[model samples]
Target: MLWTLRSPSVRHLQPCLARKLSFTPNSRLPRITKDAVREIPPSTSFREQVARSAAPKSFTSEIKTPPVRNQVIVFLVGSFAVYSIAAEQCNVETAKWTKKLSGSSLIWKVREPTSEELRKAKRLELGRKLQAGLSSLKDMTEGWSQTMRGLAVWSYIQVFQPILDAGDGKRTCWAIGGVNTLVWAAWQVPKFQPFMMKHFAHNPLSGISYTLLTSMFSHRSFLHLLFNCMALASFGKSSGVAASVHLMKEQAKNPHGIQETDVTWHFLAFYMSAGLFSGMTSHVMTSKVLYPRMIARLTSKAKPVDAAAVAKTSETITETSEKTILPSLGASGAIYAAVTLTALAFPHTEIALMIPPSFPIPIQWGVGGIVALDVIGALRGWRFFDHWAHLGGAAFGAWYYNYGPHMWNSVRATHLEASQKVQRPEKTD
Candidate 1:
């Protein structure tokens, strides 16, 4: 009879009754009323009845209050997240990639430094100097003054003067000016020479290796810097270096305009990569072939020994001379690369020579003549400059001019596809 009760108020008691009794209603149990249900003990063993008693008396009357502990936890978490992001300002992702790809600790992974990092580095340097010895406060101040002067002059000459005087707001001039400033600084500072030689020059014999890219900005000879700067000023602009005719045509035909900044970034990547490729070529030749041959020739001449004996003697000489560091540093390699690319892009364009018989010649003809001279010089072992480097640079320019664009596009497409796949949800069975 209780099971057949139709009162909606008694529905809450159904679960408690089900737990207390079997499938059949018990005859001994008292009938349930709203008042009787309300009178149920708060500490009841029956779960439903305990839950009903524990529930809020009124949903609207309950104050909206958040836990202080929860608020404190969320604030701490948010602050930590912000701190982590800020701390990663100098993220070394590119450096890590370079190190991983090269598989060499000899070559330093280089990146452009920010102002904060530069200041910190200077502080460290000054602190170390202070710890070494204290000559005089006056002397320290003077030294610091000189350093500041040099830095100010360099920055003014490179980044500011060009922008102010050129009257043209182009990214290329700023880049060129900055490089020129570095070249000038490298030449002027005696300390810089040893630093560059040890760390920046790509010498297989040297323990330090970042010189592959740094060498592109190095030029000890004033004439060399002048020549490279002239060539760069002529062709380093966006109009000349940023895009090929084919790229320009595509941009023109497309509805959306391509960003010039992207092109500039791509050109920078090409230039740095070209320098590394050129350096690698020279390193292989000097370390593996040229150095050994020189040793062999000297060994043979010294004793007039048998060929096998001479070879053995040369090996001995090489072992003894292993400590000798051989390094080639200059921007000629990268400069030649730019020249080759420019010539290939506009074969009909005329280039003027700085030396005698100075006349404008077709770019293709000029580049060919220069390349031929380099090839001859390399074979003959001319030590005036790195002819092998020139050849390597030329080869890189040609290769990049042909396949670089396609490769870059393909890489970007593949990356975009991968990202899309990751973002898309999986299908259900």
Candidate 2:
């Protein structure tokens, strides 16, 4: 009777078996079927084959084994590619409500508004005013024509056109435009003024948590919005290019491999959190040091100035929260974060300032100079801008550049492993 051994090491025991045993029909062994006792194939390493087949096929394996450098590259590259794609896909119409679920859908999607027959929208004066204008067919047609004309004018005036490859989806321009449009509208609309003041501007003492997010998009000044958008467009686009190059190189190695949305989430998380922390930094500095000093100075020097005026100033400062509460309203903090990140990601890239058109500076040097200026500004009590916020944002960008990718990968791996465990139960021997 013939028998087959399923062990991969069985081949190693062949000599021992040959010397000790002789197979005979009289031997009391169960016969192995011809199909089960097939001859070993020639020119094959059974051990290697078995090892490859039994290897873990989990995504965690893919993530956990990569070098630290590669992990960063993968994350940064993946994020850049996704950002390019996501930005290109989103438009003004969809951007208002199109949601991106951080790690899963790096892409933006508008949710279908649920039809609730039970509840009706409250009709306020503004809603009635908006509806009143659209009642007449002639007025509607005129409004439509005016809107088309305005769009044409906007298209003509747009400084940054769709120069990106169509495949990438020219979405960044829209985001920049949308932000600028909102800032412009806020200045023009009386009703929007209070909304902008409450939500768009960050006040540390306000106790509203969401101001951190909204403040990043709010700029009360036209110049502030214009300059920030310009910087974001230039540096952000350059950073995206660097990331894309890195991604393409990786894709070249494993053409069939799938990528995650980790990069997109990383960039976005880094951006938003940087803004929040930066704003908090400013708040800390002001509340702990700057505000206290101001109060002390006002109390101590009250006699030097016009006594009545000083008294009035001191009373005004004491009575109203506005004087004590410094409201920061701008995208400077977030833009600074992007600038520092871009400098780190592509240090050799040349940066040119609009003021000095003839001179070009290394990105790293430029970032260093900007950081130094912020430090000086912060120390000297320069209140022209939120220097503390700038420092905070820059610090975050540098830190994130160094360690963010590895941390991100580790988190993703942990999440994936947990999910795999939930979906697949281990078998018992």
Listed per candidate, the RMSD to the true structure in angstroms reads: 30.3, 30.2
Model 2, 1-429: lDDT tens digits are: 999878768889888878845466555777888876577555659887787786555321222211223223333454455444433322211222222222224232243321110001111323455445434433445556777856654553353233322111123434654776677677678888887888777775565555656777777777777787777666545234333223223322332222332123334545556666677667667666776665565455444457688567756756554564577877677678777877877778887789447588788898899899999999988878899999988987777667655544444445545555777978999
lDDT of 1 by residue, 370-410 (tens): 99999998899886778888999899888877876554444
Each prediction's number of clashing residue pairs:
1, 3
- Each prediction's TM-score against the native? 0.53, 0.54
Residue clash pairs of candidate 2: 87-171, 88-169, 88-171
- TM-score between candidate 2 and the true structure: 0.54
List lDDT for all candidates, in order.
0.57, 0.56
Q: Specify the highest-lDDT model's number.
A: 1
Give the Cα error of residue 3 in candidate 1, in Å: 99
lDDT of 2: 0.56
